[model samples]
Target chain A: MASPMSITALASDTIINAGAVDYLILAVYFVFVLGIGVMASRGVSDSVDFFLSGRSLPAWVTGLAFISANLGAVEIMGMSANGAEYGLPSVHYFWIGAIPAMLFLGVVMMPFYYGSKVRSVPEFMKRRFGTGAHLVNAISFAVAQLLIAGINLYLLGSIVHALLGWPLWVALIVAAAIVLSYITLGGLKAAIYNEVLQFFVIVAALTPLTIIGLRKVGGWGGLTDKITSAAVKNGTSAGDQLNSWPGNDISGFSSDLLSVVGIVFGLGFVLSFGYWTTNFVEVQRAMASDSIASGRKTPVIGAFPKMFIPFITIVPGMIAAVSVSEIIEVKAGGSVPGGSSGKGVAYNDALLYLMRDVLPNGLLGLAIAGLLAAFMAGMAANISAFNTVVSYDLVQEYLVKDRDDSFYLLVGRIATVAATVIAIFTASLAGNFSNIMDYLQTLFGFFNAPLFATFILGMFWKRMTATAGWVGLVAGTGSAILVWALTSFGNPWTLPGQGSAFLAASVAFVVDILLSIVVSLMTAPKTSAELNGLVYSETPREDLVDANEASHPWYQRTIPLAGIALVIVVILNILF
Target chain B: MSVNTTQKQHTAGILDIRNVIGALLGIYGVILTLMGLFGDTETDKTDGINANLWAGLIMLAVGIFFVAWVRVKPVVVPEDLDTGGDDPAYMEKH
Candidate 1:
């Protein structure tokens, strides 16, 4: 009989003896990436070049970077862990949660953003609501990016320390230095180029692991068979693991932690739309495209690759759920069990387990390099977005309005360094989090959930006033925080944190919408001239470049690409 | 101070930065893949899966394809593009 594969033994042994060949490959990869950063820096002369790639990026590059910005080590590792822990239901994040919002961003929102030529998302807020709203958004956005980047850094450092047996501080500092090396020199251009490169690296690394892991479990059908058998032998049913809406129930341990209702509204509509549409970290890539039409196509082009990412990301988790036991140790909680793989696979370590046990030495090095690249690029994306908002929306707008391009360029570089350092510091404080994915989503709820409401009213509704915009934002953010604190710390709650996060966001979004409407009616609405290009109805007809978009060739248009992605998503959902 | 801030340097379309990096990575990827596939079978870190060979081969192909794609359709710079201090976009930011 074949020896039983224990996750702990394999992982411990593999980390200890990763070999010199792998080390060499990693060194070479680092040197090569640094070289690219140096070369990309040659184009930098002004703030625009540093912050937005001089607005010269093509659709394909920006599109790839757009998605890659989100494909950091945390996302890859966290999603994979969720996949193993939750099974096929985990794919709800990609299919139902992500694709629709991406499509909406491309088809509906891009025209206004690109046509108006706002320097940042907060600038759009400023144009629509006034400086108060701008200050609120810019400060919150900058802080959000800092927190997210720090979490990514923390995760990357932990993974490195675990895999290489290096000190976490050493890993963090080295990674931080590498990130600053490129971004500080080339700014957004380097970040974008690296993100595009990292995108390929991620695909090259993870796709093979998914295929190999599947083969080990006897393909998709076999994998399902194994999971069901494993569950049955353990005296439980694979009800929720196999079905997306398992048990027709959303709460409790019925396949997924959240109910179908929660998944649909909280994750799919509210969270997905909030992140994909309004989050500057992802949208900045699309806004950097060379032309208005090209900018519009960025998210659409990204959506095609995005729809299929779950295969490489989540499938491994499903494989690990059945194949690897004792992947992680969970602490005691109301919803969580107090043991390692006692209830299920240790989700965070799913991809790492696969890396240690499945990939051979030479390929293992490349895979690890891919993981590292993803982490770095993810950080770069956040830093790039952070620095831009700091330089343009906050510093230049508020502090030094009459500064020249070179002066602001210097400020941008200094801000990049400052923000990255702060992120590194914040990353050190992220150790106590239970799940990276949950932590990230909760953070998103705190801001994006309410920001989405503000953006929606400001963009589509002509009657939304500046007073309404700022007041709604403040009120909405306050409500989100209040709900979070009440549920988590102040009082005992029935719902899980994720559920509370979703519900809190829903409340904030609703409150913001009602507040905006009520306040706008009470206050004076901006006249047509003041509202031009800011509000949808009041936007000048010529500014709507997409009005004649139908006349463009089908291949050159955004609608067809979006239509294709929607069809594929529907077909996949039905078939699966 | 003597140089024009608005002017962008003209580079060959086939030699776009993406293509260059892709080509370099592809070359290295192919080397690692070949070593993994045909070299000594001793000391495989990944239990039984030849992850290096597959990942490297895929990387090589993708790198070459990106390079080829750029060669086929070179990027043309819009000389009169208004993307500077005097451009309408920046002028309205204030």
Candidate 2:
């Protein structure tokens, strides 16, 4: 008879041999990361250095760190899980949603933000809109950050606990403490350096695991044959049915034609334009670069490598799907496993299951480390970002009217520790939710999608008023909540799928914009000088070669490349 | 001072064009690659035959366009840093 703790220990040992060796390695890595944070703190003589690394991070560091910041535990686990469940279609999220947004940020929005020389995104909002709108956006964003931080922490805790037989709360506290120590000491600079390290570790771990897994299944040829056979056994054809295009019958989860179109045109545009353009977390990285050129070019440079992530994350899952048939047939008399049952294997758990069953000894530790790196990288960035927002936007803006550099730095560190604790608590509680990805998307949609639309309208449209900004924000969020509620009640509100919620939110934004326009037109126009000043305040004159000029070449190159890439992707998609 | 201002404006315009072109190309390339790799066929298979061919052609066209744009709008070298006489860090070494 297996005792409870012994069973847990046995399960963990089976996965990673989490004896003294694994613990020692993880401990050393944690110490090294904390040491870097302490080293980075030497330059923190003032608030500017503490908050933004004195805006002196190089292009490569910014680029690598920015990519790493986005590459968190949620993505690592989520993508692998999605790969197990959805096949190749999950790749679309990266290709369609993330890459374009990064490109847009590098070219179009970076100049405006970096040029304005604003320390925070909310500061820019206050300048563009007004006090009320700025406060609302800032508060909403801080809350969103808390949620993201919680999710990342929860995933990290679960993975660590599963692999090491540690208590879940102990794992959560350890992860949070490790992340908070660095973020509390060095702010964004420490986070970026840590992220770069994490990125390399993560890729190194995942790459070989993928190769060996493929080899175990008799290489790509054998894997393809197995997938085809399994598809037939599951009563689906080998072709379009397997592809996750719109109008497919593989349940709502499939990335069929309608969902694809919606994601590509609607969710893709909104996510890229909104999240990258206006979101403080993303922009904060850009703002901390050594120069405007570094700020803009880093994201562009980052996109080249980021394009390959799906290959790393999604391909392995597709490979796993081929073997799942055998596992399922033997265990449950069907082509799916009972462990996952109807609700589907918890997304990240699928990746863990693969690592435990397939890999040898040392390699398993590396993969686990990679996942930990992803979680740490994400947690550091989010905590750093949250601290910056709370300290700069909320605390300093509302409470402290005048403060010395030392005061602000001290406050920033305190805020970071507070934010990490909240995130850890939230992560422990969030495990009860069934589908983490859907939950994250729905929550993100309610706030971010509409926020993106309003920002675009505000920046480009000279007539957009503060009242309109407020109304649009409320209406978009309200409509998304309503739609989410209706769908939960089994309404089956399918224009294209669950993604319709995003579309509905966007429509609400448009309606708000029109109403804002009507209201603004009835009122007098603000002077041209005021409008021009807002637009061109940070914009450098044409003649001088400002730091912003250095990034121009990369941005210029990426635009046409993106277009050509899109055309090729579409053509290949159509033919092959 | 007046001459310096005129030079700065010209450089800014040239840089702006370069940034815009780079961004567009970057976005185009990523989207095309994704569509090629995971593009849905009429039959719902992973047949990326058409997507591969098209992506190649599109890349060639865009590559040519970027080359031409760079040739036509070369960046003008500036005489001094444009730091508005603020940060000494921006001042060029003599």
Candidate 3:
């Protein structure tokens, strides 16, 4: 992947003046991206090898890739946007909402998933619950991946459009082609390897911006002073803007008690847990690990970097909120006269405006490439996971049963192309929702919350019946929809901002769990022998973990690493 | 043509992840460092700090570390990676 890059380019809309050095830096990054794909393709010998990197990637690589897959438009632009608007509470997305669930995935959920050896999350559903749940999960997951991929594609295209002065459609196609080539050539290994590289590049791109931004704001103390002063100027409490606790703006709740509850249970328990533990995009990265220990440690290993990401992402947005003219004006309740994405100079414009105002040529180019890398990584993760589910879980399982391994591999490549094309159409849908984070949170609530409930209950309680699985999923999803409509449309609304998304997810989780327990009692369960690897009680302890884990050092071991990560996150929470 | 059709391909674990990371960063570092030396240093935007120079040097150091890391600890490549499925026990025992 280290081949010297001569990245293809079109005329820059000339939004930013990119010197020769800038082009060269971007060129080098793309060359590496494609070179990794070429190198990875050599390793693919069958469908399994293509989809899971032959399940042979080391922990460090998988770990970086795990976080990188998620270090997408959501983490960078979305969180930055949130930071500009919400301030200190935005850190909650990392410390409170994300880390603990990631640790749970590494410690508890991963062993179950790794030991079972299912190709996709939906496949696991089929084996445990039956075709009804399987189909629901597979279809919903596939749809979600496509829609999210579209969001990434939309973000990626925006960059290409700015760079080339191309029409939006052309930029979207060009961006899709760039992503498609690597994935179609190399499959999951390329995606994962590029993700790791993207992780580093993303860090490289953002670190400079964060440092300069912090320096410009006269460091941390100065930043807080400015943010607090601005809060007072806006006629709001500084605590709402500067403190992490209660986080009135983040939850969009007026009552401090309700806000805390909403954040703790809604975000921490339901939404974060739902997405991190059950989403196939993230899970697929861990599943590509070389060993059970490595697989279990993947998310935990990623947590270290994940917890620190807000510094570069949200912190920059905080800097921009006080610094950038556009952001400042938007904060003052004014609009960008010729604003691109909807209502006006949106909160989402915070990062891009900061990048424009502060970064010089060479650094600016590198930063742009970094944003592009994150977008590609996100879209690549979605496409890779989408192809696997379509090929292995749906097509091979039902329509084209008993297909040869080579046949499925071909089907996978085709599915990659299909997902990319579909994503191009869906990219437009992303623009209308440039309050994209809200919709994304809504999606996670609908798809992942109920699914997490089913997975959690079924994994721990072997008595949970297959009938309960399908019924709970359907009911949980419906309840989340119902809540979303009532709150957004009219009378007696309780939550605002992301609070409604969290409320919907919490309701979904409760609905799924309660219905699962009740329906399970009324229905029949698969016998213990049949439930073997699929359920907790039916499976032995040895099956859940690596027997040789004791031989490794404490750092290399899963629990100790996870324990260390948990401690660090707790400290970060208290400190921040 | 798909790579899967050919069987004797054995480059899986041999191409270490470090090598790829090192080479890319090294290229980026060298280019940025060169620009910092020869190109116009945009001090106005960065409040007088040489961002390209400083960032480049740090990236160069880290890239070298990764390259050295591979030499110190190489990845082991299995002759066959056909070991990636459900433990045969799941189906046979059932």
Candidate 4:
């Protein structure tokens, strides 16, 4: 069933050939999503309502949106493809990489963020590092959002064109209009609600496919049995398909990239911490909850569902490796672990093939709709974050200070439209990257690795000066670029893409911490009064043990709940 | 998850939008699912499987649950805090 055309064309052809029911499913999703936007728009009176959802979200809604916002269609597609290629090891991204960091965000950092009451993540930078560092963070963040959003739009348009055979531009325009309409009108609250709905849609869509696929493969034992047989038949090591710990031998993953050390230290610590803790894209939802306690619990609540996602996404990919015959086999070479030497699927078309080959028409339509919703949710989240940072941190705080609240609100709306348009234009340029997940992870390393360092020191150590923050950020980014160049330009010593990113991020983080410490020791520290509520030790926003909270059972507390999550993750790693 | 009892009687905050969207999608999902299952003209697009029926039921369950949640726990605004429109808590000074 694979198309004999270009990689992009094959995906479009698959979607274009989908049944009519799929189209109807998509149409309903579009109408309902737009309706939510219109409804959300009715109460917007100022910037706060638009940007922060009026600080009225409950923990459940915020939690779902927080994870859904990160659960972009690209993530689904990329991770699934990784599953097909790498097998069981890919599950590590979920179990080990994501859960711990999310819990850390909620249990440790939320007090500082919610207590200080900064509007945007970069605004937090301004509070901790002063104007110069804030500008660096705000400007970098704005650029990153645009790039990521543009990538999402490009992917959505490509998927629609692949599935429906419509012109890519038509799909792009329609998607852009729908996202812009709802996001511009409803703002963050509308975006949050829609994301929660999208999460349900995605679960509903993929779960059936996983069940059906599992049944066909004869359950877990059957799946492993078939993949192992295929790998052996194809002149590949079955170990590659079965093992989570890529072994020490040359036949396993290249030593630089697929080691447990790389995954644990580089990904679990530096990369995951940087992306989850500091990046505004995910943090904005947490900051929007009704109370500090609820706000703090957002990410911890999100981590539960996050742990289960690999079952729906990665499992299907593993099934595809053995079940989908059209997966184009490639000649084994560097970094390409031995898999069936038959045909290999387009690295990105794994999920599209699953829907096309596995799902029936009616269910396929719903699945397509869910995936569509996922795409929109991802775009909307980015656009909302972009608008918030641009309008508040960049414009309202610096350029147009003292503008009436209504004026800033209008500016936010305008910025939303402008950012969407810019993303539309940039989407056309997004076809260069081959693997979306790897590319994004690399990008995170580039900017956020150093930023996370700054956040860690700034929040915990009062002696960390503003100049130190700026210097560390610059040095960190510079180090990341240097490491990336060494790897990409074929310096014989560097690791694979993930390894390079892992090493660079680790290097940048260490550099940032050391540089900041040295610089802070030499520079004048901000006074105790100025540092109040900003640093960890001197903050007044610390809530003394709430009598109400204390009275509740220990299981209900955030720490205990997080403890439960940690235990569950540990058990899953051992089992899987 | 307890609803705030201090809210005004008729504030828009009473209606949780999650319920509304959930209910709408769920209802439509059920209709399409039924059409796939009961309608004689249903095509064997999913290898003779009733995919529509299953998907619709899922949506129906999701919709019913959201609607039920809203009915069970209507969100209310806190009486003590401003609705947060143009309020100082929301607005930041340079």
How many steric clashes does model 2 contain? 64
User: Which candidate tops lDDT?
Assistant: 3
DockQ, candidate 4, comes to 0.28
lDDT-best of 1 and 2: 1
DockQ of 3: 0.25
Candidate 4 shows a clash count of: 18
Candidate 3 or 2, higher DockQ: 3
lDDT of 2 by residue, B1-94 (tens): 0133344433333222233333333333344344445543212111223332244245436545755655665444233323222121211111
State the displacement of the C-alpha of residue A536, model 4, in Å, after optimal TM-score superposition. Answer: 1.2
Q: Is the docking of candidate 2 incorrect, acceptable, medium or high quality?
A: incorrect
The TM-score of predicted model 1 comes to 0.88
lDDT of 3 by residue, A1-576 (tens): 000111112223334556677777878888888887787777677887899877777777899998898888656877888888888888888888888999999999998888999988998999999999999999888888888788678767766565535577887887788889999988998999899989888898899999988888889988989888887787767677677888888888889999999989988988888889998989999998877888898999999999899899889989999988888888877776423343356676678778777777777888878888888988999999999999988899889998689899999999999999999987877665445534564555478889999999999999999999999999999999889878877678855677788888899999999999999999988899978988988899899988868777787788999889889988877877
Ranking by lDDT: 3, 4, 1, 2
Q: Write the per-residue lDDT of candidate 4 for residues A137-221, one digit (tens) a residue.
A: 9998898788778878877887776676668888889999999999888899889988988888788888878877777778889
Instruction: For candidate 4, give the docking quality class from DockQ.
Output: acceptable
- Pull out the clashing pairs in model 3: A1-A35, A1-A36
**Model number 4 iRMSD:** 5.0
Reference-based lDDT, residue A116, model 3 = 90
Per-prediction DockQ, in order?
Answer: 0.25, 0.03, 0.25, 0.28
